[model samples]
Target: MMRPIYLLLGLILSLAGLRAQNLTAPLLSGSWQSTYHNPAMVHFLPQPVTLGLPGLANDLRLENLQYKDIFVEEGGRRILDFTAWSDLVDEQNTVQDVYSFETFGLAVQRGRLGLSLYHRLRVEGEAQYSRTLVDLIALGNAPFIGQTVELAPQGEVVSFHEVGLGLSYALTDKIAVGGRVKYLVGTSGVQLAEGGSIQLRTAEESFALTLEQDVRVNTVNALEYERLDSFTLDYDPTRLSFSELTGANTGLAFDFGIAVNLDRLRLNASVVDLGASIDWTEDVSSFRFTGTETFDGLDLLEDLLRDTISLATAVDSLLLTYEPERSTAGFQSQIGASVYLGGEYDITERLTAGAMLVLEDRLGELQPAVALLGRYAVADWLQVGINLNHRTGIRTNLGLHLYASPGRVRVFASSDKFFTLLSTGNTALAGVRLGLSLALGQRAAERPGRSRSSFASLP
Candidate 1:
């Protein structure tokens, strides 16, 4: 049937020309739970009782956001729309490995003063396709009519489903701070066009083949789709099946924190999540553009003037080229930090062993990693733990935590970049983080039969 309508109009004009050469580039900031730690999980919180205002405290932490094999050895692609045609093809760039979201949080204390509530959820799937074979010249230097072919583009499929919320405060007990406000609801995708079909072979005698089509299709009614997860626009499977592009000017993000504790030997430092940015104006009530022209022996060619004034000048030249209405009011920014050290010397008298050393910093040029936590207690409810995190190209996370009896049900497991390794340049993400925590009403009356000598003689 006309070669599947010219291969579906050359795969929708090479997915609108690789989304206009990947909207230019430069936009991959940071901040997404800092990959792990300081997520307020506070070592799986549940040990604070001085309500009578002695050390002042109120905290809550729940963990479960496992990440597969994060950065799978720089293997496992994720987003490379086009490194500007990477020198014609040596091949590299196109991966959006999806799998994110499964978070919940809440923290409140009143001694050193503290308050927190954070939530992040995501659902993304990506796909990439490429094909190139272009070489066309002479548009003003007559060389030999009928011999020019071009179709420089490959393939793509982007999907991002989202949900986020944040709030944090901590002025003491080691310094604390926070901020968050995000909503990306959902988004769908499909993009394939860089150089898929362009054939031109000439031996003269009566040859004829000329092609230099630069198709155009633009749409960027931003609601925040490139910073802190922002994507919406569904239904378009040849007539509709990816419609859900939500917008009404919803985009604003922020976060900051700093924690520290050094009791003469044991240590702890913090600069938890810190991200704030927004710039995505909305106004793209459905765009349109389609082109097709085939000729081999003449069956009827020649019909110019594509549609909708070249799709509104390709969405106003891709919003003036990558959110350029003067830097879209605010480009992108994110920061992260964490450092910890633990101590405890005792092998008898009920047994005890502890160890901790962690260092981290994301967004600021990327590159920083170190994690190791260990603990063991034989009796009195039993306790055992171990956690190791490493990043030298991402990937390397091991975990195991078990605290039975009176510990209000604690069990954990990990291995697979723990939380999809973050920083040092994200490469999609791996997955796994199952969790459950419940200790209602004043933390179940301070568990452990609540009797530290009858509340230590009623305070």
Candidate 2:
């Protein structure tokens, strides 16, 4: 019951946000994996067949907050601390979360047509809040003795699996068009309704607090609540079932892209995750908290120093101060979407440089980012590259990428925020992509005078 809420509050307050970029993946035009960012890149997939084994890409875009601001070491133990959040919090804040893993994949070419099939797991998380919300909860009513605090706390966590099919056709050597269709199976989620809110007011004369709540939250097999003398909700994320993963929650999404190839330059554009929404129709619970109560009870600072309560627990209790109206209802939620416009030029037979502008819609806001990348094909079998990015949360992010096709086996790894690997406490964004695969057919060769190899060529 309360434990789930407490942990959830901790998650939002200590959020490590997500903003992802695969700056190098898309630059390998001849590799089948490059199509992940832009479906049209499929047109360049090396002849006959390319088989994918296993891969994962985890990208994060952190803004306005860091790991240091959320947790502190105390009494030889690490605990969630928000005591000084007033200086660390922003007027409005949002965090986006996503993780992707490809389980299996295959790509085949027939003349000017290319087809691909892939299965992947996708996890998404989101949370939004106002500075006043954190301040009132962490510091309590003393600072707001004569003032009113408006609180807006929103968060969501959802996970699903997708099986997809993609197709691309090269209308000409210089132009290509492609699209992908995905079938999704949702496993679990906890999400808030659009524009939910709460308010608290402390009287100037008596300092009494009046609290109001008007928020709706939805759950899809995310929590199991038990009511006894005390309240508890058993929440164990590890308890997963294969059958439920492929159960009643399902949806479809599409991705489309176009690529234009010039003698020494390439122009690309794509809209990814279009109409990407999931229908949560099973084990669904809806909660509506629209009540007003005279709030009394917890003192945050005294309770903590006395080792009696925590800020997360206090806020958890505050949320349940009023009973909520519950129902069994189903709903739909859309995944975040992004658009990319890019251009790359071949500086030399072995060197390529590129730039891209991206606009993504996350939590009802459009975030913009720009990236520059340079790659070198050292030989037909080895390739290396680097990327520099300027996005909303960070000023500059340095990246490294490497892919080697020694014989029929291909090994690859990349990152646009390699700095985060050194210290998560110092960097706001952290991400990396690792992959291993095989290409059994014609081992991607070049024309007598042209080279399309990502790695340094091996005789």
Candidate 3:
């Protein structure tokens, strides 16, 4: 029975799960892709009619954990080492990944009104964990004899497709406002519900193990259990039906944005996924767990990770002591939201410098970050930019963004991990956005020495 506690703590952690702010997406200016940053951005687009062929973007963030910080070379082989990185972990660490695609989209501009209709598919998931848990697992409980280490691993994943209608209007050529209404079709998912978590602590006397469990999980064909020892959390568990994956759930969300221009200075503000929530109603189940037990032998947890005890033995032993309660019920969950506030100053006909303040809601906590960036148009067909973003006690990130428009076809890409491409990086944050579209309109003739990339005010 005591060994089961070790099995729960030692191994369930190595596996992976924040939303990262988009600092460079909007700088491309005058493209269908840029409008996603802030719907009001449509007012500054150079083309009259923009048709989105198809495009997708991925934003990823892993805080307080980095590959370079955890791995080292030993005997010509890469070894798993956490000696230099564990202490730097935050009280509540996060891993967020967001992927979105604009399947079919269209934007039309007329006099003072801009209208758009599009279908976007988005899949977002995040995991939030406590640093105390990592410390206890890596350094063991000897560091604090009288203190109690309390922590739990938490995460959620959700997928959905949405059809959105957006509208933008210019009060004056210098000021524009926009909003979007989205109807979401919820898909299959698994999420740790609110008021659900487990705490583990080690007592000084006998070095006893005290694990307090309080876990409630909501599922939509993502989790199933015949018994504690017989369960599956895989993507397709054979129990999932098509109705649960296609239209078993539903949600609603709204987005609003405003863009203002004053001479060479431009200001933009927007909120995404505001008041977004989904209700899982079909093929749903809830698992409720609440209990506490004190057993001697906190020191045996490390050995549990080794082959000393078979997993079957540990799980069966755990079932003898702990039994989770299960029921058929529906639960509602929210899709987190983010707000962006930024301003840019034109340094030259082809250069713009800006700063952005990003605020994101993780579960229920508010996290703030800042970005400083600049964009330049090398020529009418190419634009490039650089960005530097920072967070306290986490890490500093540097990135690049680019946009190219050859004739009526437009393409763009952005990343916060120029130092770490794809999934490789020494920093705590890595993100990339790539997409392509076609601008269908008469190309604006270039003015003498002025650049077409210049977000010229609406005429």
| Local distance difference test, candidate 2 | 0.68
Q: Which number leads on lDDT?
A: 2
The TM-score values for the models, in the order shown, are 0.27, 0.87, 0.83
Cα RMSD for candidate 2?
Answer: 4.2
- When summed lDDT is taken over every stretch of 10 residues in candidate 3, the lowest stretch is 11-20
Residue 84 accuracy (lDDT) in model 1 = 22
Residues 310-356, model 2: lDDT tens digits = 55355445334445677888988788788888877889887878888
Candidate 3, pairs of clashing residues: 18-95, 18-96
| Model 1 bad stretches (over 4 Å) | 1-116, 119-207, 210-218, 222-282, 294-459
lDDT assessment of candidate 1:
0.29
What is the lDDT of every predicted structure here?
Answer: 0.29, 0.68, 0.66
Model 1, total clashes? 34
Please give the RMSD of candidate 1 to the true structure.
Answer: 18.2
How many residue pairs of model 2 clash at the backbone? 14
Candidate 2, residue 260: CA error in Å?
Answer: 2.3
Model 2 alpha-carbon drift over 4 Å, by segment: 1-8, 11-21, 228-242, 296-322, 424-429, 447-459
What is the TM-score of candidate 1?
0.27
Please identify which of the two predictions, 2 or 3, would achieve the higher TM-score against the true structure: 2
Better of 1 and 3 by TM-score: 3
